[model samples]
Target: MTMTRKDIGLATRRAVLGDAHVARAQEATTAFDAPFQDLIAEGAWGRVWTSEAISRRERSMLTIALLAALGHDEELAMHCRATVRTGASAEDVREALMHVAIYAGVPAANRALKIAKAVFAEMAADTDQTDSEKGGDHDKG
Candidate 1:
C-alpha cells in the first residue's frame, strides 16, 4: 500500500522528535486545532523535514538558528532537546547561535544559549540516571 503524505509526515516527525513527543501532541490535539496539526504534519514534517537536500543534523542546527532568531523560545528549547536525536552536538548549537548573535541579535542568541544549556543539562542528568540504573558508567550524547 502506498503511504499518504500524512503517513510520511507522521513517520518523519516521529523519527525526528521521537514517539513520546508525537504521542503527547496527538493526545493534546483537539477538533479546533486538528487542521493546524495536519498542516504542519504535511508541510513542515513532510515537505521540509523529509526532504533529502540536507542531513537531519544540519537541519537541526538551521532550525535552531531560525527559532532563536525569531524569538520562538518554546520551540527553540524543544529543538535543543531534540539535538540528541538529530545528532546535533552542543557545539553545533553553540556555533549556530553564534551566527544568530551576529546576523540576528545578541539578545536572541543569549536567550537561546540559556535554553540550550538547560536542556543539555537535563539530558545529561537523564543519561546519568539511566546509566546508574543499569549499573554502568555509560556515556550518552
Candidate 2:
C-alpha cells in the first residue's frame, strides 16, 4: 500500500529527530496546534526531508544554517540534536553557524552557536549515560 504524506512524514521525522523527541511533540500537541503540526509533518518532513536530492547530513547542515539565519533558536537547537542521527558533525555545525554569522549577522550566529553548544553537551551527556548503562569501555579495562 502506498504511504500517505503524514505516514511518510512521520517516518522521516522520527528517523531524523528520534522517537523520543517526536513522541513528546506529538503528546504535547494541543487541539489548536495539532493541525499546524500535521502541516509541518506533511510539508516539511514528507516533502522536503524525504527528498532524495540531498543527503540527510547535507540537509541537517542546511537546516541548521537556515534556522540560525532566521533566528529560530528552538528549532536550531532541536536540529542540532538531530545532527547525531543525521551524520552532521559538530565541526559541520560550527561551519554552518559561521556561515550564518557572515550572511545573517554576528548576533544571530552567536546565539545559534550557543544553542548548538548546549545541544551538543546534552547529546554527549546522554551518550555517556547510555554507555555507562551498557557497561561500555570500563568493562573492557
Which RMSD values do the candidates have, in order? 3.6, 2.3
What digit string (tens of lDDT, one per residue) describes model 2 on residues 46-95?
Answer: 99999999999999999999999998988999899898899999999999
Off by over 4 Å in 2: 136-141
Residue pairs whose backbone atoms clash in candidate 1: none
lDDT of 1 by residue, 1-141 (tens): 998888899999998888999999999999999999999999999889999999999999999999999999999988998888899999999999999999999999999999999999999999999879777534442
Write down the TM-score for model 2: 0.90
The lDDT, on a scale of 0 to 1, for candidate 1 is: 0.94
Q: Provide the overall lDDT of each model, using Cα atoms, as 2-decimal numbers.
A: 0.94, 0.94
Tell me how candidate 2 scores on lDDT: 0.94
